[model samples]
Every structure is written in C-alpha cells, then in structure tokens.
Target: MSETTPVSELNEAEARAELARLAAQLQRANRLYHAEDAPELSDADYDALKRRNADIESLFPALKRPDSPSDQVGARAADGFSKVSHAVRMMSLGNGFDDDDIADFDRSIRKYLGLSSDAPLSYTAEPKIDGLSLSLRYEKGRLVQAATRGDGEVGENVTANARTVGDIPHDIENAPDIFEVRGEVYMSHADFDDLNARQVASGGKTFANPRNAAAGSLRQLDASITASRPLRFFAYAWGELSAPIAATQMEAIDRLRAFGFQTNDLTRLCPSLSDMLAHYRDIEAQRSTLGYDIDGVVYKVNDLALQARLGFRSTTPRWAIAHKFPAELAWTRLEGIDIQVGRTGALSPVARLHPVTVGGVVVSNATLHNEDYIAGRDAKGGAIRGGKDIRVGDWVQVYRAGDVIPKVADVDLSKRPKDSVPYAFPTKCPECGSDAIREDGDAVRRCTGGLICPAQAVEKLKHFVSRKAFDIEGLGAKQIEMFHGDPVLPINTPADIFTLQNRDASNLARLKNRDGWGETSASNLFAAIDEKRAIELGRLLFALGIRHVGEVGARDLALHYLDWDAMAQAIDAARPAALAQRKADAAEEAERQAAASDNRRARVKEARDAAIANSDVPPAAASAWSDLIGIDGIGTTLGLSLSDAFANPDERRAFDDLRQHLTIVSPDAPASDSPVAGKTVVFTGTLEKMTRAEAKARAEALGAKVSGSVSQKTDLLVAGPGAGSKAKKAADLGIETLDEDSWLQLIGDA
Candidate 1:
C-alpha cells in the first residue's frame, strides 16, 4: 500500500539462492563486528541491505525462515563464561511513544474478552533500569548459572563472575528444583565515576557512561576482569520456575529480597492513576539523587490474573509501561546563534551561550533543533522566534531531555534590553557560504553544501567512529574533531580509516614530540587499530553511518540475514519476487478460508443433531460450564489476541516477519519430568481444600502444567465459580476435563 513501486517477483529457487547468499555474507560480518569488535561497513550501507532483504522476504513469505543471518539474536560463546540455553525464551518488549499507545493496548485486552470499561484494573510501578539484562539459574537450591540475555534462548554463561556479587545467593533452603531469575546488571553512579577516574589514572580507555561500562565489563572474556569491576544486580523478572512465592507483584519483590537478591526499594503501590502520577512526580523530583541510572518508571498491572488477562504484545507485555519524567531545564543568556550545514545539506542552528550549568555540567552551547522548534509556539501560544535573530543581551532558557544534549527552550522576553532590536534569521550556511532553503512543512533551513562543509564532515566522521560504530580505539571524538579539515590529516570516509595505517610510523614519530601524545600510547593506539581488522556483521552494519539504524537494529539485521554475501544478494535480487508472492498467497488464503467457513456451517447441523441425541447437557450444564472456566493461568485476552492475529490477513503478514527471523527452539516443549503428566484433575468453587497456589505447585511437582480452563485436551480444571465465561466456553468445546473433587481424588489416590 505504500507509494513506492513493488519489488520484482522471484521463483522459489531464485529466492532460496538469494537468501542463502545473504545469510553467509551477513554471518561473516557479524563475526567481525560482535565477536571481534571490528567493523567493515557503515550503518547506512547495512540498513540498506537489511531493507532489501526484507523486501525479498515480503515477496517470498515462505522463504522468510527463522535462523537466518538476518535474525542475529545471540552472539557466539563468549570466551570466559560457559554458555547456557534458556528454559523459556526471554523476548524483548515492544515500545510506545505516548499515552494513547498505552490506552490502545488496554483496549486490545477488552476486545479479546467481552469486558466493559468499568472492570477494575491495577498496575505495578517500578523503574526501567538502564543496564545489561541477565538471567540467574538455580538448581537443587544451589546457584548454577548466570547468563547474559543472548538471543532470548541461549546466552553467554557468567556464573563464576555472578558468584562474586555479594547480593546473589550461592545457596538457599527449601528451594525449587529449577529457578531462573532475571535482573539488570548495572554499575552504580559513584562506582562508574570511580572506575573512570581509575581508567584515566592508568591511561586506559574510559567508557562514555556507566551503562556502556557495565555492558563492556560484564562481556569481558575473563571472569576475574568482571569481578574487578564495580558491578551490581537488581532482580526484576523470572523465567523457568517451580514454586509461587508471592501472591502479587509487590510480594514477589519481597520474596526476591528474602532470597538475598537486591531489588529497588523505591517501588510504591498506588491506588489510582492520580496517585501513580504523584509517585512519578516524587521520583522526578529526586531523580538526580538516585545512585543508579533509570530512564523511566515501569507500571505493571499488579494482579497476577489481570496481568495474565492483559497478556503480552509481540514485543512487550501489555500489563506494563514506562512513565518517563519531564526533561531537565536551566536558565542562561543566549549570546549568539550559528548555522551549520549537514551531509544532506540541511542547515542546523546552534545557540552559543555564556557558560552556564544545566544538571551538573557546564553548557556553553545548545542545539536550536530547527526553525519550527524555535519559531513554533508552545501550548500557551508563546512564539518561538529563531534563536539566530535574538540579540546578544537577551536571556534564554536551556533544557536537556533524558540526559541528552541541551537545547534552547525559550528567550526570556522580560530580560530583553530596551536597546535590543529583533534580528533576521540567516539565509546562508555560516560555515560553507552556501544558499539556504526552507522546505515546506519543515522548520529546518539547510545549506546546499554536501561533503563541502567542515562542520558537517567533522560531525559525520566523529559519528562514524563512535563507540557504537566502528569502535576504533585511537579515534576519540576530540581527536576526530581536531583532525577535521587539518591539511595534514584530512580524513572523511571509512576508507580514510584504512589510510591512517600508512601514517603509523610518521604518527608515532610525531607522537613522541607532541603534547599529551606519548610514544607508548601512540603505539598502543595503532596496535588497537590493527587488532580491529576483522569486524562482526552487526558492528559493521552499525558503523555504516545509516540514518536511523542503531546497535540493536544492526544486531537484529545480522541475526535475521546470517551473512553479508547472502544479505547483499537478497537486496540485489529477491526483494521483488518476495513481495509478489505475498500478494498471491493472501488471495489464495482468502479462498481457502471461505471454503472452510462453508464446511463449518454444514458441520454445525450435524453437531446440533449429535448434541440432541447425546442429551447429557441438561444434567452436565452446572459443572460442565464451571470446568470449562476453571483452568488456572489461561486468560481470555491472550486467546483472543492470538485468534485475531491468526484470523487477519494483514496482521498475519506483519507477524510473518517474526516467524521468518525468530528461531524459537523449544528446549523442553513436552515436559519429560512433569509431576502430574498423566492425571485427571479439577479445581472447583472457592475451595479451602488447598490454596490454588499450593495446589498448582504440588501438581507441577508431580509433572503437571496447569491449564487455565477445561477442554477436550484438558485433563482437569479446578473450578471456582465466578468461573463465569470460561466454564461455558469449555463445555461448548466438549473437552473431557475434570472438576476440583475429581482432581483432589486423583491426587489423594496418588
């Protein structure tokens, strides 16, 4: 439906060939980037290849198989740790930009069940910690494995390093046979600063921030190296589990604490949205005081059943959302505004200010963002005159959003001097002397200069070799800027990076004579460059300088495609064919569905006659309905979401992407040691017989995974009235399930 021309059609053989080629190419790239920490391509180039591969798959849906190079989820085994396969796949959460998106998720839950708006709902509020995700597994009440959240199914083992954390328990009493707890691995603010100070003192590379350092440290090949770093853990979730320790989310936190895991004590339980908002505000007020990093507060539906009912989205759970705080603000004087041209010829405004502190750092300049951001008025209707025209004597408000770069918020009109006059915005680039044009619906005034502006080249080069890019060791942002436009070292593209090796001898010679550039460190820098020749696929993709592609996206592309050659070929050939096949499949599927519907209607008459002859419903009605509704852990919402997605043509196509790339290898889909495997059981009306929690635990111990409701496939349902709709649905489905009494009898008999 997009305006762009559809891709070409390809035969199945051709599609297969292209996919194969793409997989191999991408896989090689991934090895160089992720495993070796070197890069071969820019982010832009990688994104283009990914898009091409996606197009090919759109045409050839059947070819979009899981385990492709394009689906780069987990990396190869890290050197220092033993690898562990996850009992349950740890899927990443989907993101939302606004409150409306959250409300829509809530509505989806209602549509699945025939629920009205008044149905009471509650959510738990916790911080969305900005750090590395980890999984800790326990067996026989003893710590066994600690793993990074690799590809969701398999991860790098870090048990030895994890054991070093004082908060993690090495052993516990009365523990389940298997327990997998999930948490964030982070470096505390104080620890991060101290670590950086040490790095500076030792003349070693310092990380940009704590999050980066934590990830780097935890991923180190040596457990001893990880133990040396100031790392901490906070438990947030659980996977592969045996017993229920908590009745609610809050109680779960307490249980984790009792087990010797550290959890954020800042969590609060609120009765209403207003109260939740108040808590959010309180946290915002104390944001700077927190010892660790957090981007926002995550709100989750508190009730377990309700959360189950709300269920999960493809990426994130609908039961939870992150509420972010307002951007930090500060006041300062705007002395001047300068124009800088970009690679794409867009003119950007930079505001120069008298050095003023915002948050904790001195900011002498802030981004004006664009003409629209500057000239567009706020909700109160105050105009945003361009920062360029503001007189030198005027005061301005500066603000930083989510710890990002500062931006000019507004000009304080009250602080304007009587002698000040309104100045005109620039019509040309300040750096390149090129004509500037303003496009329709765009606030940006851009210069026509491309690859010609010194500022643009400097910024681009800096971004290209950034921490998340090629990750070149010697090329810091300052060094890149310093070399920019210098006649002696005029470097621009990624190719220029290779050229630097030629200057190694001369650079080392000059290093010994230069300020802050000693011979030993210079030698180390070149050696680091030599060490990064073989980059991984994902890192190569990230380094390509693509618009909108980041580290995570790059990784996704590599896993899905597998290798660079296959990826490149797919882009060059299969896209057109894949798209065409998708359209044909949609039509064929529709016809099949119509035929199936007709068959179902014919079967309905037979079903009615059979029901009348069987005639047991009159006596069975009461318990049958209850049994249908009494299955534990199953919810109507999840069922409905699954049904709707399967039923819709477009939704199916969209989810087809996940199917194409995601390799959900079930390690134990059919439980082997299930405690209640071959038993008939049921739960019934508010029994004090055993708490549902205790019963479920015992049943699982006996090899059972409890079903939410009764059905032909169900062995039993524990009934509780208010069992409501589930009971009726189960009876209609005609499942040979049992009730609480029968369930108890079997267990007692055992």
Candidate 2:
C-alpha cells in the first residue's frame, strides 16, 4: 500500500504488512538521526509515521510486536566512542499533532489523576529543541563528564566534546552535590550558516542542518575538532540529582538559569489548558526569530508531585507530550518527471525538483501520485490544486506531511516558465520496453511485463531476500543486485539463488576469483545459503514474493495447512469452485450496475463474458475452496491472491522448484478452546461499542475467522446500527446474529 493509503481503508493483511514496513522505516530513521547524525526525515513526516503506528496499534492491539515503533528511541552508541551506561535513562516524549490531540492529552491526565473533567491542571510549555541530547555530570559545582543519549540506557562518552560547546558551563555554582544536567547541544542558525559558508570556501563537507551539524560536531572523536565547531547547549532537564532543585518545573528552569546554564526564556507555566495552547502558539509565532531550531512545544505537568503521580510509560513520561507543528511547504521548480518500476511492475511517476529545504530536509524529488494527480484530478475525478496541472519547468509548492515522499501540493502559475510543457508520462516500461497499462480500478499504470523485465525481476529477488523474508545475511540489496547482473552467475529467481554455488562449482571463473569477493567470503556465502536449506513454512511462503502474501498472511497459510502438500492439494481442488463463484459474483455486480446505470449493464456483461471465455480456470470443489479462504483473517480477497499464485502454471513451477531445495517446517496449530474458536465471523455497520478494527482484533484473538462479507460458510454475524445487506444475508443464510453489546459479552471485552 502507498504511504498515503488511509488507515480506515486497510484490511488486516495490509495493516500487518504496513506495520512491518513502518518498523523498518522508523528504525532506519533512528539510526540516521542518532548514530550517523545525518537526519533524513522531516519533523512532520516522522510525526506522521508515529501517529499512524499508534493508530494501527490502537485498532489491532493483538498484532502489536515487541519492537514496535513506539518502543524505539535512539540508536546504539557509535563505534569510536566508549559506551557509558546511564544512571538514569533518557526517554523520548509522546507527540500531539493537532489541537484535539492536545485536549485528549489533558483529558487523559485528568482521568489518570482521578480529577474532575473541569479540574484545572497546571503545565509548563517549552520549545522542543531540535538537536542532540546531552547529559552533563557535575559534582560539587564542577563539571566531570558528559555523554550522548544512545538507545536510552547507554550513551557515547563525549565529555571532552561537551566541554568545547560554548553554552555548556565548564563549572557551575550553587548546584546539587551530584547533578546530571540534561540539555540539547545545538548550533544556532547564524552559526550554522557561517560554518557551512566556511566549509564551502575550504571545500569541506557541509552539514545538512543545524541539528546534524551540532550532533556531528559534539560526537567527534577528536576534541579539537569539536572545539573548532560553534555549538551551544540549553539546560532543560535533569537525569540524576543528589537533591531536589525545585518543587515546580518552571522554578527548576529558573534554578538552572541561576546556576550559570542557558535556559529557554520562552518556557512558561500554564495554569490552564488554554494558557498552554496559547503559549505554544506564541512560541511557534516567534520560532523563526529564535535563531535556533525547534520542531514543537513540550508540555509537562508543572507540579513535581503530579509528575511523579503521572510517572512513565516505558519510553515516555505520562505527564508530558510534545505538540508538533504541521507540515512545512517550500517552492521549487519542477525540473522533470521520472517513471520508476517496482516489483509489482507499478509505474510510479516521480517529480524531479530543484533542490529545496523543507523543515531541514533537502528534497530533490517528490511523488506525483499518478497521471490523474499530474492532471490536477483525483481517482474520483474531483478537482485538486484548483485544477491546475503540473508541468516541467513550472514552479511547484511541495509539502511533506503524512507522506514518506514529499508531494507537489500546488503549482504557481505566476512563476510558470515560458518554455514549460505538459509532462508526457511514459506509456511503456523504460527498462524492459514493455507495454505499461492502467487496470480499470487502479490509479497507477503498471508494466505488463512480469519477471522477464529486469526492473521487476531484480526487485522481486530483493524482496525474496528482504530482512522479513529469507534474510540471507550477506546477500543484502546491493549484493542481490550485483548477483543478478552477473553475466555468468546471474541469480534470476529464488530457485537460482539456491543453485548458484552448484553452477559456480562447474564454471572455470569461480565466484571467489571475482572482484571484491574473497575465498572466505565466497565460502561464507555458500554456507549462508546452505544454512537456510531447512526453512520455516511462514518464511518460505513469504520469501516467494507472491502478491498479497505478506508476513502475516503467509503465517496464516502456514498454520492452516501445517505442511506444503496439504496447501498445494487444497489450492488445486478449489480452482473450480473459485471459477464458478467468480461468474456468479460478476452477474450480481452487473445486476447492481443495471440499477445504477442501464448503459453499464451491457458493457459489464460483455466484459465478464470475455473474462470467463479467456480464463483457463477449472471448476473448484466447494468444500476445498471454502477451506482455502476459511482461515481466520484470510478472507476471499487475500485468498484470491494466494490462489492465483499457485493456480498459474509458471508460478506453480517456480514454487515447486524452490520447494525442492528446502525442508519446510510446519507451524504449530493455535490451541484455543473459546466458544468462538474456528467460527467464521462477519462484522458490519456502525459499531458503537468498538471500532471495526477493534472488533476484528477481538474476534481473531479468540480464534475466530473474521470475514468482511457474509457467505454460506459464515457461522456468525455481529451486526450494529445501520447494518444492511450483510445482516439480511446472514438471516437468509441462517447464520447466528449478535448485536454490538452481545459481541462484547461473547468476546469478554465487556
């Protein structure tokens, strides 16, 4: 699914896959910021990913993994620096994206504190500095050591580096006997600009932003290098203290200021939620003039006692939340448009932009959505950007918000270049020269060429060896690309990967003799391949790179069938049944279209006839077909993708060839004894007790099969208000029906 795919629209399979992808993305983002000190994600984009992860977890709490995005904070300490175990962990704060989120935070605090809804709660709101977090240790008014926040608990020892930062006090007076003052090490806007200018003059490597500059400078292995860089520190927190400095948050900031530390003057003590919000706005308004980078406003309970009562939740303080700013927009010239092909043969259009900075990240490219979006229309033909089409050489406004890739939000006609022309999106795959066609319901055009196309073939191979799939440790993406493009030892398929060592054994020019390959490395590569010969059924299935068969779906199939033979036989038996059902579904759809538009009925009927006549699908055995899709959460839609993967001759041959090289492990059966266990359940209409996702998660957790629609195999239907066709169908089919309240009682959620 696209990053912009709505959370509500995603099915269980999609949600699971999306969550896995997000985990990898967020982890990489953490490394980029904390380890490498080269931040790639903008504040808005990073905030969006976290929000999406939270939303999905709320909806499907059962599927939440141990290493969820929420659990990640900073990366591990870098190689050169000595690791320091923190006495008190440095934690990240939860974020609030909107005004409602702020209100919810307040309400949650009040509820947790057992206060009335209208009870007044005081808070201290301060700018969330965009910089490297530093912990400065001072004992008896003398600085001793300093460290960077690394994976929360352990940090890089940078005592010498910290001493070079200008705003950091070498020694402070009137401080606690043991004080670990925590603060942000940042480079001011003016200093950063001047530093970059000097770097350019000397042909030195310049930093991407002030935050990165500060981080890189402060983490330098050489103290002299850090001394040469202009960095400032702002003391706002304390990690470990021998004695309490103040009773309130604001007073503590003042105390830090009094102890020869630079503290934000904009920090305010808000007596009410409105005051907090007002202060946030005031700080935001003054942000550009502040001379330093700040992404959001951090709000914390003012009273220390209340803060203790609120306590913490793993990585974040329950008493505080960061109210993040919205997406930032920047104008850039549209240089050109490029078409990129993926594993699925999706011909995605990307805008090549004149490099411009948006919220600290330099973006030279943006996703154009699709041809419809370039023409200023949505999938539904609705006007977007006031119907102004994007073109090469046009001045376009790009925004990075909830999107992983920046998008062209608006095009300025006033700055249109006289030589600009309408972008002609490619009609064929540039890599393989194959026809690219857009399917009826699909917004993006896709290349018709499948595995034969190098773009799709290489991408599929990459996915086959992805971290969540086969995960051949040495055969990462770059290695996969190198192996695929090898003239003699080319790995074209999953089967080819296994056969490589055997093929190389017979070749005159050996793999070890190749450039960048050593005898030990070659032997290790072969050993890694041999090590994975006996593979888990779920991993094997997922590694096949079958359409719609993600990690969770593969596991579902693995658990259901237990072994490979059973799954293959069932798929073979169900083909005929699926064929008959498809025709019936087509007729039903045509009849509905007849009511909506008389003209579409004939056209749809003709199309259905053409599809059926051309289809080589054999009739299915009703029982087998039902069992194939009957697995809980493996509904008809995902089942169809699974079926198609095996039903096709080429794909089946490839699967069998790959299977020959591996010993597959059968998954353990779910040992649930609940009343709803193994029952096919369907949820429909406006559920008042819980959301659709919550309902699905509950049913699945109790070992029930959750289906999106009603069928003859459906055992139960949980109907809420406004339940329509599904409810009537359940009644007609004699399936058991339950209300929202009844469902909750049955699932023990009540």
**Candidate with maximal lDDT:** 2
Model 1 stretches with alpha carbons more than 4 Å out:
1-80, 309-315, 323-750
| Model 2 misplacement above 4 A | 1-71, 74-323, 401-404, 417-421, 576-623, 670-750
lDDT by residue (83-188, candidate 1, tens digit) is 6788877655433323445566456555444345656655567777877788888988899888887656677887887887766789976666888889988888
Query: Could you tell me the lDDT of residue 710 within candidate 2?
Result: 78
Candidate 1 at 377: error in angstroms? 15
Q: Show pairs that collide, candidate 2.
A: 576-618, 576-619, 576-620, 577-620
CA lDDT of each candidate?
0.59, 0.81
lDDT of 2: 0.81
